[model samples]
Target: MNRLRAVPKQRLLTSALLLAIASPALAQVAEPVSPSEATELDAVMVTGIRGSLTSSMNLKRDAQGVVDGIVAEDIGKFPDTNLAESLQRISGVSIDRSQGEGSKVTVRDVGPDFNLVLLNGRQMPASSIEATNASNSRAFDFANLASESISGVEVFKTSRAATATGGIGATINIKTARPLESEPLANVGMKAVHDSSVDNLPKPMQGGKWTGEMSGIFSTKTDDGRFGIALSGSYQERDFGYNEAAVGGGWYAFPGGEGPLANADPAVNATNPPGPGDIYSIPQNLIYAINGVSRQRTNGQATLQWAPTDTITATLDYTYAENRIQQRRHELSTWFNQAASQTSWTDGPIAAP
Candidate 1:
């Protein structure tokens, strides 16, 4: 028996400093400090790739179950273009690429549909045309969510008591920025996207221009720390094309290298004859198709938090993403319904034409 795992299987000290002086005659109990009398320590903010990696390492060490994560170094600043690309950095995770971009993810050996995705601990609904079952749409498309507004992503490989249910393979939680956690700031970004695949197509079918991407985020918190708000949105466009030439119905094999469409005779049909136990196969159809595809993805999120007390907080957030696709296809193909005048093949164990 063998086990499968290649990842090299690679702490809280709380000490209360009590400044108390005891006298022999009378004993005075140390009074707890009130909120007004307590000293407020300055908050330490860490940013950059190293800082984010440290944060991820700390989370994994402190978590109760098998877990991994990626944290953003700063607000609206993630290393990858989208969430799906970031997830691929984790061990035991793979993604399905669409048009040179990541779409969905597979955790461990399980498929995408069974993996659960959550936004700030709330269940996120996903739908796809690739779904094998119509009854449920459980696979979330990571490409739909841009990385600008995201703060961090956590992947739990094992089921835990507090997390959401129905993640047979793994549960992924997407954490966004909150008013209190994020400092008061406003940021905007612009990017130019150019895909050479579109330009490589026929001049008539090509989208000859480049696309654009824009994102902005604003976060604010009240001076009293009682109320906070965050708003972020991203818009991205992609112009790409897919050209494929392949066999559609696959090849059908014939025993003894003879079928209704082909004969085993080397003199008339092929250069080599088929042995008694040899086999041959021929393609049913030859297909060549070209498609010009355009895609636009929009993502927006608004979060509001009210922290009436330091220990108790109420958070309300709404996240929305829309993906639109337009495509034009031109295809040229041949179906093997009519026999050709002559087809030839070289010498081999089995004949082919």
Candidate 2:
């Protein structure tokens, strides 16, 4: 017989003794647990946004330097369209917009040229093309990498022993999924994107439309979990644009008795009757510019891993990516002759026409 015991307190003893007296006696024989019952036991697996956030918190806690990170909800499930867009979520990070899309990042108010980007611990070069020449800019274009097939990204805001020497502002490390660490799996995804602002463009300036993206990943390992292979690929297309009205030619300031507004003396146009010494001016040019941009990106990676012992492992991987862009610009502007009939002006200390 087993006894339920508690400290011998005056009030506690009454409840313990009553409970023990009311309960049934236990069996002395032990029973075996069935295999079916053991197999039916519940198991918990972390996944989705909660899992990603947990992983990110862990990465920050474990990484060196002032590190911040973003982890995927699952394989190939980064929510942003590209790397720069996702990076903007971190504090002290901002992006330079190119054709209405995030192109490069500025960390801690430092320019992108001084920042370094790494792929699986190897520094990657930055390159882009122009009409007349191929300029080798140090700024990495984050728009080139498809957001799919990502495992995580870590940003080091300060230098440490492991930090590469050149990136004074920050060092960015992009991580991809590895097969050996994962269970066998296959996944495919597709997307369609549309930019409503394209419709706001003038008839001749509006050609952008919906685009499509496709991506997939596959991973497998031998029964022993020592040898594994992972393959991933993504193709994405996008149409984007920027439209604005501005004085791109720059403003021209006129003196008291100069320029078209100064020459024209209309009593109704002036805030008050214009004196000969009053200063006024007209716009250099009223211009509206419409810009359209299109981009196509493709990415592919293959990884193979072999681990013969718990202490040592060998891995080989190959990654390839390509980005192509097409752009066009159209402008409509206004200019007036200095003659009083062609233009009317208001006289004041400021320029107006």
Question: Residue by residue across 128-196, what tens digits does model 1's lDDT show?
Answer: 533335536568878778899999999999999999789998999999998898679899999898788
lDDT of 2 by residue, 172-290 (tens): 99988789987888999887887776676666666658888899999999999899999999998877677878763323334344455544544434444334454444556678888
What 10-residue stretch in candidate 1 is worst by lDDT? 10-19
Give the Cα RMSD of candidate 2. Answer: 8.8
True-structure Cα RMSD, model 1: 16.9
lDDT of 2: 0.78
- Every model: Cα RMSD to truth: 16.9, 8.8
Best by TM-score: 1
Candidate 2 — which residues are off by over 4 angstroms?
A: 1-42, 128-132, 201-208, 249-287, 333-353
- Give all candidates' CA lDDT scores: 0.81, 0.78
